[model samples]
Target: MAIGLSREQAPPQAVEHEPVRRRRRPVLVAVIVIAVVLVALFVGWIGIRAVLARQQLEAAQPSASAVVAAMRSGDVAGAKSAAESLSAHAAQAASLTGDPIWRLGEGIPLVGPNLAAVRVVASATDSVAREVVTPLVGVSATIDPRSLKPTDGRIDLARLAAAQPVVAKAQTAFHAAAAGVAGVSTASLIEPVGTAVDRLDSLFAQSSPVIDALGNSTKLLPGMLGQNGPRNILVVAQNPAELRATGGLIGSVALIHADHGALTLQAQEAGTSIGPWPTAVSDIPDATVGIYGPLVGRYLQDANYTPDFPMAATTIAAMWERAHGGTVDSVLTTDPVVLSALLKATGPVALSSGDTITSANAVPLLLSDVYARYPASSQQDAFFSSAAAAIFTKLAAGHLDSGKLLTAFSAAGTSERLRIWSAHADEQKVLATTTLAGALPVSTPQAAGIGVYLNDATGSKMDYYLGASVSAGAEVCRFDFRPTSLVRVTLTNRAPANAGTALPKYVTGGGTYGVPPGEILTRVVVYGPAGGLLAGTQLGSDPVRIVSGTDRARPVAVVPVQLKPGESKTVTVQFLNARQVGPGLNVATTPLPPNAGSTPDVGARTTVARIAHVCDSRVK
Candidate 1:
């Protein structure tokens, strides 16, 4: 080995490999630097997209609002312009949210759900802008609500029919958009994202009913308004001063004839004069009679005792036909509140009695003051007839602002102060889906309904001073493996402390019905969702006897509440074994005074599973 030691033999391999390793080190460093730069660029791009998308969404809201406002105000050009702006913002937002890189970012751990929520909102907004508002704006120029106003007592049905198809499409698109937003889960979303999603959900939920009603009206209006033949509709004016289940006791009745949208007042009479029919006017179900009693059939004023408006309208129409000897194709019920709402459009009318009835004084003059001014039934009837005539004359003059008129109809209809029933099966089929139909409480795929109806047991106008509100809830308990739902109805007597001595005898009933003067006896009727069972009822936290019955397959409980002046009471009803549940609950109460705007509270325990979708025995 010593003999072979030379300079080349010492480190030939080391010298050759040193430069190669140095070159490779620089190349590896460059690769890592490039990779880091690429990742940073990707993240930065996503951040910029998110910001732009959010800005687009925020900007679209005002455009959407403007479109709705312009349409309501009958500015078709403004609506179109706003619609275009909405479309632009919504499209860009949708595109930004739908990008592949954005979709990939939706998989990130803590930020993923928020990203997904943003995407969902963007998609829904874009769909609504492109599918719903755009088509509606396209037709807005042709189908003006103002054009539908009565001209010489006739509405132009042709224009309504022309816009029906497009209106129906918009309704369908709206429902789809609503479903898209409703399907997104908010559990994992951050607070801001969850709140934004919830707000969009609420808009869809509230607007669905209005859109549905529009579609239904356009579908049924032509036939119901006598496009095929002449139709006789009975208009029953309900007096809310004396509370009834639907609105109030029928005060005045008028007959209207409709031929191809032309309306004419054919005859007028007091509801009191209709009958005391010798027997039941229509064959009523025993269940109905058991709940409402025979008075509903024999007396026109008692027809609304049943909370079902169709039954009430049927009886009222039958009684009128028997007395007047004419066919009644339909029946409509409205109270003084509705008339006052319409007065805003009709302007002030001078009554034959030299009194001016404006929107401001219509309610008091018609409901409270009229009773005090004319004590006798006949004199009251004369005044009502005169007032009705004066209002009708003003309406016939055709000087109304159509927007205000529609707004009046919407307010009255939503509050249950106005209702309509069609005798024709086809027309009724469409109407049954509407609030105007006045059907009983039933659970749907989207909501569960409970009804709290008030019927006066006092034979007086004392309800003029009554105020009521309703709230409901459900419970879930592990120890108790049964469903339990509770309904609370709070009744307040707003009457003066000296109502016993200060009020008119007619208004107070003079204690004729065994109730003390100024005391209100209300038969409070509570109905649970269809196929539910009544567990128990309480009056002010104490158990009480309830007169129980069933209607439309729903459990009903009747409790009598007697309240003195300046008194308040709360009635509670408990329901068990609900046959169905829905994502939300709706409580339908008797329409109270216009000033009493009740907000319904309905919910279930957060821990329960399928509480909104299934009727589980172990949960409410």
Candidate 2:
């Protein structure tokens, strides 16, 4: 029929279908063009919102820091202004990220989680700025850390008490904000978005502790500083020249009495005046006696050998009570490094001997030069006592730059150069959670704890020139599916080649304790992660004798090494079968001399690199 219907005889239906097909093509093209335009508009809207939110966040981030700085400096007006700025910027950022359209984008396929994370971060940041930081700014003048400084030898505890409620409220709000930010999922996020979330989380985590410390200070300091009654605080000045697990041997001891915030130096004495007791001053823990020997309680110098500051403080307090009868309250320990830190606040202190100790010269003068300047123990002790008194005299004048003072204490606390132990159970419980307490190494779910402690066995000041460093790594390349950890400690004798003849006999030990002159003898103790076993120990490439024991359920390995002048050694301890240990390592070492250049070059160790990667894929 179609062949017959050709030329002028074409069918009517065929003619009609051609024009319809032609018309539908134009309509289809129009529909596709409209769809492309709409999609472009939608993506552009999301991009604009994200850009605005990010810009607002960038503007607001600096305000929180400014508020903290201003409040610390006791500038109420500046703090208030910063708080307002923070509120304004954070609120805008939160609004931009929380709109209906922005939330709708969070329901999209591939990029949904990224959008969701940004929104969560914005909301949490706004909540913290408005809820915690702004309210805290109101009470900033009252709880200023600078204000906590002793004015006329008395800190006004009433200020802390008055601000307690505000600080507590702020702490609660900050924790909630932190938890909220922590809940955001980083997976499936774009690189920039993931990184922003990570940095935000880190800021929250870091600031949470500061708030916690503030809360703790307001809560605990009033009672401990004797707002209601008299309290005694023992001050131990540790000398790091002769290394001990906790800084060094307690060289000088002092007692301070506090009543209604008033402080008075009750008494001061040399550590030698205290006991090498006839027996342990208190019942020493079996683990302590086994790892550190009974000398931990017998001798004041050996009290900190166990690396548990509370135990050490208790033993020292007992001995102090025995020698000078009084109720023991709390103990504070500081080393020359801490003294150097404090010196930055006190300025240069002039001694009676016409010598000056500045922050620049404090470490060398106190830890080394003092030994050389005084040949007799009595003379050295007198010099130390005089130096302590001079520093105290400067501090008592109360003319300090409050910022410098706080920085000094913060640095000391961070490095564990300064530590405190309270006799009160409640106070100790709080202190246990802080680095200031010098508690034993604590393992968390994210990190495995290991401790490398050093004690001087040479009975000399030689450790002033001894350098030490600790590096740790973990491996899961075993068949048993348990982690294997290694803690490597490098010890170097930085003494001069002629130290035997050039150094004083007292400083060199003069062959005392079977260590040759100018030689350093150190007893190294390694504490494995809790519930771990000591596989073995190595001194360089050879097996070394290790006295194995357990402390606080952690396996302990002790090794002794003696090095002559200009010598170095490495001690490695292997820990096996550690249960529930994280992929990361938390390694703590004894505080070394400020001049000790002992930081390990981890990148140079191929073994560490290989083993550190074994758990990368398997662990979370």
Candidate 3:
């Protein structure tokens, strides 16, 4: 067997064969180990891919479901939150699927599956955005959702549906991607879930109907018309006449409507007459006229005319004469239209001067004619006719007859007594005739010649008739008379043989005579200390002399004067017993100057006194 063993020959030892067997055994063991390792690796990869696929599928399904549910429930915020979570997971999953590790199998195992899941998440987000966001945007743009009508809601729904195509496409892609990912093994599933969640969040961000509604409602119209508001109107008128007419029209108009709201009429005559005309006409019948008195009076006072009588005559006589020739009677008789025209032109008539005409001595004759001609029934008619009769009677009398004059005087006297008695009853308590006896000092200068005189500061000349028993020779040392707010007196001295002998200066006694300081004296007249006139003055020099010894004569040259300083003298003033006068003076009062004292006594008579003066030389 050992003959010439060539290089390719066979071995002959069993030991060598054993070595080869041993080597074979080791090689086989190594192969088995490799096979096991490969098996394990395959199983692990498959398991990972399966798990990822399941996870991606699970994540996609739920996120999509959640968005759908949120949308259905109208919970845009919840839907968005869920969608964002899902999208984040989807993104993570997509990233993992695209990793080099996932590509080791050419992305066959996990990439497609994971991408599919991501697509699903994205699609869900898109769906949510379309379903909720678009409508929300529309509502925000158009109207506040809270205020939107049901119709608006329907409109918004339609808009949302119109936007659904994009979302549907996105959903389709997501489903396709998710199916792809499920078909293959993917490395990650979180990415698609994350994408869906993010999209959903975005959609929800746009769903702000409530907020939009609130914002829209904050505008002007709703707030003003709604609960809180002010109710007011500003009305104006043109002229006083128009205002009055408008007012009357309005008042009359109200009687027409039964259910009209509260109505008020006012007149503003300051500007023009046309301003209120339109409003008056519109308001109608319920308005009042704000015209002047003369106009109003023309329409109201009665009109009766006779040759000897005129009834309720106003400046009507003057107005009539001015308009036509002759007296009111002739015109009225000649043309009735003239009276009608006068009445129409003037509006309403009032009697302002009847008292004066009634006092004339011819009143009886005038009244007789009116009483005979016009038979009046009503009070107004009677008043008119009686007044007319009085006028006619006076005219017929030719002049003021004694009977008529006496009657007029009696009426006038009665009226005056009533007025004076009412006014002075209270003041009469303190004033007395004896109070006028004094050598009061005057603070202002007086006129010359009359040493001292009682003056009517009202600019009215008063007659002071002297009484009996006052002697011409007697010196008036002191004088007393009734006190009034109108009279003031001053003292002076007669000129001596020397041309420049200064007049006597008067001074007031600092006694409580009840008269206010600076008050002008009125009514009371004073002479010398005794009941006698001042002597040494001839009748020519002193035309106004106090009569004595039972003769009645008004003291002449006794005029009122303002007092001058240091012109103090004593004189006796007496109140003459004479026939009572007729209607007391109706002199108008003048306001005291600003610098006048605030003392009660000072201002008391100022209200009724016709005369007032401010001794402040500082004023021009």
Candidate 4:
């Protein structure tokens, strides 16, 4: 109590003795706070790095082998599930880096193995997932799914993005080229160039979105690495046409390959494998032959034999063998046109002994036999006609035969009676006929009887005969004749004694004539020498009679006559008759009793006198 009086000494003694007790609460609390903060910061940094790394890895993945395998194995649903899980994990990791709540978790020690596994799994999963989703994205990717190979999986986001601009540029160039092509006319040399341009345009239009996405993903690559890096990518075009069209857009990076006999291609980058390249160029327009070969072969097979589809299998086989030096079976699978062409070349082959030729090599044997038996000309014509007919039939039928007929024709050679058989065959086939006027006897006399006979009437049953009297008393005349339902007769008077003869008495004998007398007599028409119709009172009255010294002899005239069924008689008429005038000679006859005019009567005599006078004038 009095320590203040004794000040220093008393106070120091009491202070030490009172309590050696010390509180550790404050220090402990401060230590705990510092430890927590350090842990949080470290955790945050690690998490952020991991998330970023994971994102980078994910973006880099592009290989589709896993996805393809999954799909092939019918694990589509599983693949999708895996993809979703990976996406979620990536998203979670991304959040930990930027968000304060994830700070504690960030400091958690990550085993190197676990981290590497995550990255590997993420990359693999992404590659597969992307492939699975690519088709759903539509046709917007510069890379074709079909052309993609498993090794392409190694392509990182940066490379993919880099390729996008090239693809875009290529697309733009293609469109420009296409525009240039479009400006050209079909006849222009540049017209063919347009086909490539059009294809590129289509590809670019479809792949724009995918290319852009790829580019965006690639853009993120620089951030993923500690330092900027350069990457190289390989682009291969299986088709030369495609390469020519799109190569410019890809700059120097594009590899060009021509799909010829053995699907040849060149790679820009030495590391790329030729095996993955498409065996054929499917995207090019001219590549249709390659793309549709199988389809065409099928069509040929189904084609009708009557129409000769698929031509001949043996013929095709032979051609294939000749072209590629392969056996028939091998050629059939690789090139069906061989069979078709062969069949066509061989014509039709039929076995005289069996349903089919029984030779070890039926097609070749039959072809040899036909060649030996028939002349080249006959074979060619028969084969060609039969082939043509078969094609026509198939076209009309709207379907095809398996080319059995074509094959038969090809093997048989044109010498086979294929044409004859075809004429009677009920199967669909084309029928064609050509008619030419018959030859006339050189000695045939003017005003004499003449007839036309058809040489080949295989399909036709009836006979058609045409008759005409020669002008100027000529013994023969030429004419143009064709098959028809009607018969025509032409008469000309060239007798010096009957220059102005009245219409002659047309006598129909032998066979019952089907012409009416009025029609037979009324159709005579006359023309002046200058090829003008005769005028004045004569007009048509004496169409058959020509007045001598009247602006030269009458010009050639045409007369058309008709006959009634079962009628035969001689029609007597006078030239310049009052009833026959200027385009007024059309007439019909009334049925009369037979033999009524067997003898001459007063009227008949008068008619004859008038005709004689007309004849006399021309004779003078």
Candidate 5:
């Protein structure tokens, strides 16, 4: 019995325990094998989900581009089709990302926020496709461009009235989508997640304003266009050749009347009609008078020395009120390029002078060549009046494709070349929010508001051959000396040395204005942001004389640059008090108003670089 027990019970209990432990090992092994299989499958499923989501997103992007293109071209039906396709593809993408695998990814440590961000953005895009883009398609179809056309010298107010609600509803829906997009948070996300969010950010930024403008147009149209009775509007043509703050000198003016949409050009006048304000406008700011000199009060048209178009418009209205007893509903201001833009849709227009104004040659003929072609001021003035009257008559007669004309108007308005002001307070309130309002930009908070302005000091129209460029950047090369704001403005005189002899005396201001022929004398006025100080100014390697003073509490520095023929020199302006440069660096320049003379060999460029968190830089 003992031997049998030793063999059977274990070589007693020890033997029994050994086999039991062996069985336990196999059970543990089987559990581990099952776990390994599950882990591999789970990892593979997550990887596959990510790849599939990326693929679908890639497919949806092209469709999105098509939708944007169609929408911009006013192809409502095409946009709708494109948007629907985008919605379907985007929905599929969202569904794929909505799977359990992606939900699990949201629990991952480092990549969790990024994964969630992708889903949120995808969903938002899908929502926009449904709520904003789709509705706008119908709105476009509802509002017929031809309805705005005048018949029997009158507009069909009933058509515009019918379309107003459609536009208003679309506006509301677009604003909601913009709000939704604005509400998305991608704070913790990094790299491509942040980049992806930014991709569509500007789309909402631009579309919201456009839709709001369109919506306001629906409301303002009937009243301003005289759907009820009769309305009179003043149109001012600004000549950018002299380079005023807003655009150029006020060279021409016209009075347009719209009675029940029957548009007519009542009278065309030169800038001379309004003459001067008679006395200084009591409301004129001290800084404006100081910068523009006596001209601000001398002539009504010269009051646009401030970059604020509203200020100019208000001054114009008050001055005009003195001459004409009646009040105007609004004032529309446009530059030479605006005329060219309109002509693009209208084809060539024949002026009363028997001169044809084509889009291709409008700028040269009207702005520069006009002076060369007609030396006498009287002849030039007459020709301008005729051109203005001719355009008004043709447009009212519906001689152009209405859609293209609308698009051209849109182009002009967005480019800041076309501006409007309303006498009606309620209408102005709505317009103030849109880009068309033309109000002086509010001072950007914290950051320095450096402004560089150009004024012709030559007492002649010699700015035509002048090229100027301004740039602001951090000069990191000399980092040890407390980082300063480096602003460089370059001006070139491309005229020939004998230009005065070769060009007509009238074109050269008859040598009556100061300076040799072809020489460009410019007063470069550089204003430091509030709290910012001017450190120094340089002409190439040599320092230029800088006269400093206060402009509306902001520091102003004026530098005189007189360039001989074929001379190119750069003016470097340094600013000291840059406590809060902000995270963004602004280098601003406007292409010198499309060059007062030629089509330009080079264009004006404004460079903006964001170099926040740089070592040894003060960016608050």
Candidate 6:
């Protein structure tokens, strides 16, 4: 036993313990190898799921785009297919993102909230794809928009009444899905994931409202289109040549009566046919009266002198009532641009003057060259009346493409080129929520919208040659600073250099009213951010007199700028909107004629060069 206890030769029990130690090494190595393999497997699994999620998400984008295009084009079948594909992709992404590895990773401290947010967003995408867009697409497919158009020249109110439930259901689904998505927070999300969250938020915000509006419109359209007794609406064709706040002086007017699915175009007359109102004009601001004077209260055609459509509509209704001895249900105003849009579907309309107007030349013919072609206002009025009647006849006969025409009409309203006002409380309720209502947007200390209202000081059709645009840039958007904007409006007169002699006398206003031969006198009214101040104003380096006032509680500046043949002038105004509010600076301008001889120029923009990091820098 003593000999066995030596260093080389230990006792039997000690030798047995050494062998046990050796066995422990092998066991430890085995456990370490297993742990390494397990760790490697888990990491690789996470990598695989992440890559799958990314691929699914990336693939979902174009499918979403296809759905949007289909929605716009009224291609319901395409929308459904694309939405289904998107739903599949979203489901796959959600599955990959929700796998065990990612679930465990979601509990890690720094990345936990982000991963959870990713899950929430993925779930929202799946819901929106499956629940929100698909149902709407189904409704769109069921409702033949062409059926909504009057086939016998009358709106089928029964058809509209029947489709109401479909639209309503779609609306409800959209809002529910949108609300669920809105409940999710993406504030802590990271990188591309955060971007997706933002996009989905925007899509819901946008898509839901549109469907909501559609539902609301459909709810009221049937009754308004004459489900109840017959409805009479005064249709006014405004002339962009004699630019007024809304468009131009009423070039023509027609009494249109609708019953069931039938449309009757009654007596048609030119602006000259409308007499002065029997009652005194109401709601005329002192500023408008200051410039337009007694003329503002006299003529029904001049009702649009004020930029407010509701006020003008009331005055127009009053005038129509006074002249015809009864009030109308509504007043519908459209310009050459809208006419051009209509022509695209109705085909070429031949005028009694032996001239044919297609969509390509309607704007130019109505606004510009008509003066050159015809000297007398009576002749011009006759041409307009003929064009209108032709379109009415074609639409009444259902000879044109109804879907294309309806879409064009919709596009016009969305562009704010088509404005309608209803005297009926129910119809007004429907219109209030749409741009078609043409109500000036309300601006607050936090959010402000811009208005560019123009009036013809020339008493001529010179506005046809006028090109106008506006650009807005923030003076400072720094932290803790009150955000201000500097807006620049440029007016260009593209009248021929020899406008006085080379152009026809009628085209240049025929030197009537003793005005300058080629000068375009424009009364430029700039409406700044609703609650913002008019910091200052300048016209081409010269200080112009700025007359400040409020239109329906919104601030406005009336500054007049004149341009001669081939002349361009720029006007600059500074304003302060909500300190850190949205939409930056919303600019609303009068829509230009879409079918001019050359490009009809009118646009709005936001610039960064004038964006000041500090609060005090100028936008120059």
> Judged by TM-score, which candidate is best?
2
lDDT of 3 by residue, 1-620 (tens): 56787667857654557778978998999999999997678556644754674475457557756755775455667766766665555544444444444444444554444444444434443333344333433333233222222231111233333333433344344344334323432235455444544444443334332222222223211222111222111111111000111110000100000011111221111111112221211111111122011222232111110001112122223333333334221111101111122222222233333433221222221212222343332332345334333333332233323223222222322211101100122222211111111111111111111112222221110101111111111111222321111122323322122211221111111112432222222221322221212222222233233322211122222322232222323223322212212112221111111111111111121232223321211111
Ranking by lDDT: 2, 1, 6, 5, 3, 4
> Which runs of model 5 end up more than 4 angstroms from their true locations?
1-59, 66-77, 92-107, 143-198, 202-224, 227-231, 437-448, 475-483, 511-513, 539-548, 551-553, 577-583, 587-620
Give the whole-model CA lDDT for all candidates, comma-separated.
Answer: 0.82, 0.83, 0.28, 0.26, 0.69, 0.73
Q: Model 3, stretches more than 4 Å misplaced?
A: 1-21, 52-62, 88-165, 171-620
| Candidate 4 Cα misplacement greater than 4 A, ranges | 1-11, 14-22, 25-90, 93-620
- lDDT at 416, model 5: 63
For each candidate, how many residue pairs have backbone atoms clashing (under 3 Å)? Answer: 0, 0, 144, 47, 5, 3
TM-score of each: 0.84, 0.87, 0.19, 0.18, 0.80, 0.81
Against the true structure, candidate 1 reaches a TM-score of 0.84
Task: List pairs with backbone clashes in candidate 5.
Answer: 9-12, 153-262, 154-262, 155-261, 464-597
Candidate 6 vs. true structure, TM-score: 0.81
What would the TM-score be for candidate 5 when compared with the true structure? 0.80
How would you encode candidate 4's per-residue C-alpha lDDT over 214-236 as one tens digit per residue?
33323332222111332111221
Q: What is the C-alpha RMSD of each candidate to the true structure, in Å?
A: 6.5, 7.1, 41.9, 37.2, 6.1, 6.6
- Model 2 scores a TM of 0.87
Please give the ranking of all candidate structures by TM-score, highest first, separated by commas. Answer: 2, 1, 6, 5, 3, 4
Candidate 1 Cα errors over 4 Å, as ranges: 1-49, 99-115, 190-192, 444-448, 469-471, 477-481, 490-505, 566-569, 580-585, 594-620
Task: Estimate candidate 4's RMSD in Å.
Answer: 37.2
